[model samples]
Target chain A: MTGHEERFDSVAAYALGALPPAEAAAIKEHLQTCALCREEYAYLRPAVTAVAYSAEACTDAGSGAVAVSPLLKSRIMKRVRSEAASREAARRIWPAYALAAACVAIAIVTGLTDLSLNRQNDAQRQTIADLAAPDARRHFFAGGEVVTHGGRIYIAMRNLPALPAGRVFQAWTLARGATRVAPSSTFAPGSGGVAVVALPEAATNIAAVAVSVEPYGGSSQPTTKPIAVVRI
Target chain B: MERVRLRDADAFEALYDGYHRLVYGVAMRVLADPGAAEDVTQAVFLKVWSSPALFQGGSFGAWIARVARNRAVDLARSRSSHGESQLDETLVVEEDLEDTALANIDGERVRKALARLPVEQREPIELGFFGGATQDQIARQTGLPLGTVKTRIRTGLRRLRNALEDALTV
Candidate 1:
């Protein structure tokens, strides 16, 4: 109902999420090409987000204080520990090809030629063969996907941001009802933000696969939040 | 956040200890159900642990508050179809407010800033933001014209932004 310029008036409302769906969508579309509107949005957006901080915890009439249950923290930490332990196990189980795949990723990421490039190429070809396997099943996550076939897992991610110095991308896997995620491999993306890792482990019991940025040589556990976690 | 991202359970527990109240309070305000609020609190912290990268950078407080509110509002919408849930994608704050007065803002400061708003301006924002009411619903509930509701919300947010910016400066 408003012109492109007049849409400026809705920035605050838009930031507060007060607009109707159609109107909000219109403003969202308009902001894409309008630097002025986008700037205003960027400015006021924080204030809008900050408003939620005004909320107070509900107080009990008798106790005069309301706090979250202690069990909640325990529950959360329990899950976090479980995930960490799983990833640690995955790291411990890092197979030979997993290391080679990690080497390939590092080679691509750092632009360094590896003496074992030929051996890594064989691993890469194995990944391709696994990808083309009739039994290959693909699982998708946020930035990329995993394909599993005949006990081998092939992971391909695109547009991954460059890792910091002394950091590498590591993969982890979780088996069904298992307490830990097994470290599958570690690799870095090429300049184009592309990474391809191949795991030669049997995929029969694996339930999920994830990728994270870890320190060089990889860690016994994930040292960063996973960039992607694909459930098979 | 750095430690937590490193899969440090202790660091994450410290984060939860510091922010659980804020996250739960925001959810409680929206849902008004202790059980539901607890569930949302748990979900929020779990999300922080599971996907710390989702939080790019900013006032961790404000970011988590928004995450709490969005999750609570989503639950509220699913329980009863009063209004569409605000898309999380749209709610992504592009500019980090880390350098502003809002960076260290707390509940009391924000509450006082909100209280300073004129009742007419404050009511519509509260309705839309916390109550998850659309402008049309706000108009119906408050018996005001739709345009008036929109104007008041816009005006209120601008004033709130200015007030927050001024809170720390003065």
Candidate 2:
């Protein structure tokens, strides 16, 4: 307790998981020798655990709330089974393939091509979220959320009606204190009235976001009033 | 655990059924994305399946929770490529505290305890723990000195330690 005050703060941070990796690693090493810090960490663990556990039930997505798709389990289980089969096959064929492996190695490499191209697309986007405000007016009972990772933005909408065959929904961003709005992206909803639009730039200091119907492809300037708007 | 280590599908399924929701929830809170939460949840389970030795003799729930949280944080860090140094008030989701970790405890008591802490102490803790901001990021976002942020977090945690104990006792 006498000299442990210096590292005590980090123990608390470690419990909350707010420390960066290097600092967290350094603290973990120190905890092995510092009984005082370990005691402090133990005391904080429960309260922190409780806090994290409480977050389990939070759903801020409102009507657009998304859950882990039931189909995902089947997909994972299928992959697991396939991997197991592959391992077994490799084990049985190892000694035989070991002889000609070097000669056919290039062919085996070519065989694996495009095995995961679709999955790679999903994997690259990473972060996905539903964005909505409580007072947002729903058009045709449609709601949506904005998902972002790095500098990319993906907007996913639900219950949105199909536009005129030649029209598309254009997204606009109203930055705080800016008079002119920036056009974000344009796309038509996909099947089941669900649509996802990926934008090239990160949305920053956005005060309001809206969508409007525009002619085929889209217009540099909105051709009509916004169909829906959410004040960020 | 042994069954899972042996690649028993039934054992793995049971573990997933019991813990997937909690794992998904923790991830949702941190990453605020359902797709990402689902991905993290699947990854956490796969991690358990691939490395069952990590859970041979410990609380399974705690292990999964810790793993879920660590994965979620890692994803959040990647989401914020500039690091978590730019939290604004708009970024804070003001969910009812009762709906949080204090759900099982006396909400009013815990609220009162948190309310009693100085703003300086409470703000940092809230931003760091709940908002997922790092200490350096918190200092930059709040315009507070770096040393001050560290001191406040330490002082705040100490106060919370006392407050939580007292609230639970009462």
Candidate 3:
């Protein structure tokens, strides 16, 4: 095992919810960038879970195991069904983007496109202004360079491997004093291993921004250490 | 999970029926309060329903148990009650969780290994896991130095991992 591998017994501590808040948060950030630790964690989770449950010998009602309230089950089931129905409804409808695109096409054809074009130009100018802000910070890591400006993050990278079909590189940010690494956006590299993704909202209170390989549509958490991290 | 993926109400209900106790038990074990545990349990199932895709084909029981424990700990911290000593001997036993956990891990072997643990190592582990105490809290509660508490817990986990490996070989 490598020197860093030796500290992973804390993964057990992490799984058990025994670590102090800041320490736990630090471990989580490290776990995002360490595949070896993630693998060890995956292997140890079931065992630790067994230990956690065995810590309490819950029996049936006659055996002194506390019974869950019957009302809880009904309440849970009711919420689940309601959510499932809503999801089904959502799936059957057209996504907002498609509808918005169609409306824009109609407006342009009707000669009412000036206002829409002006709004798009304003957004483009704002993006340019954000990138040009004097307080912008720039840094580089394994894959490429990152810049944060005016509450927005931009990653320009070359040398990232071409993602397989249905996979993308996800951007993540660890805000100052935050325990969880929040996901920002997703993109795939273009021709010749070049990719650029901008996260307009990733600059708030963030200490660093990173990119990780993830399944298409992105993951809420990184499964492995990032290909690159731009420390703020 | 397949049925859950399909959004089948019957399958969801069946899942709830099977795992409610384990979920509720883990929450109660940590929170030490039935009302809070019940709320956590309900919230957990609701999360499962909303994001069935999060399972990623792992052991369903372990996933739910992990969520239950984390949520319970969060609730305990929010209530500022984690520091209050709440250890109960009846709840914490020498038995292994494998005995009843859905993962079917080897309980007897784990029990034997836990029984063999040095008291110095075992005490901190128990205080941390069963009592929901951090290393600093364990140190304060046991009057052991912080470094000593950290050493004992890490050593205990290392030993437990070794014992588990031995059991797998057997």
Go through the candidates in order and give each one's DockQ: 0.45, 0.16, 0.24
**Tens digits of lDDT, candidate 3, A36-107:** 766655555545655555534243466665667788888888887786665555333212322223233223
- Model 1 bad stretches (over 4 Å): A56-66, A95-232, B81-101, B166-170
Better candidate by TM-score, 1 or 2: 1
lDDT of 1 at B135: 80
Please tell me how candidate 1 rates in CAPRI terms.
acceptable
Q: What is the TM-score of each candidate against the true structure?
A: 0.63, 0.48, 0.53
Candidate lDDT (C-alpha), each = 0.72, 0.60, 0.64
- Compose the digit string of candidate 1's lDDT tens values, residues B68-130: 877787788777765433323223333333423355677778888889999999898888888
Fnat of model 3, as a fraction: 0.32
lDDT of 1 by residue, A153-218 (tens): 778776789889999888898988997887777777854576766664578888888888898888
lDDT of 3 at B113: 69
Candidate 3: residue A205 Cα off by (Å): 17
Off by over 4 Å in 2: A1-3, A58-66, A81-232, B82-123, B129-132, B145-148, B151-170
For model 1 chain A, the run of ten residues with the poorest summed lDDT: A91-100
lDDT of 2 by residue, A1-232 (tens): 4446667767777766677768877777778788887777766655665444545542334534334566767877776676555444533432243212312221221232355766433433232211122111112213755543333444546567878889878888777898877876776665556655545455456666678888876787777998777664
Candidate 2 residue-wise lDDT, B58-137, digit = tens: 34554566667777766777668865422222111111111112223432344566678899988887677666777888
Q: Against the true structure, whose TM-score is highest?
A: 1
How much is B96 displaced in model 2, in angstroms?
33
Number of the candidate with higher DockQ, 1 or 3: 1
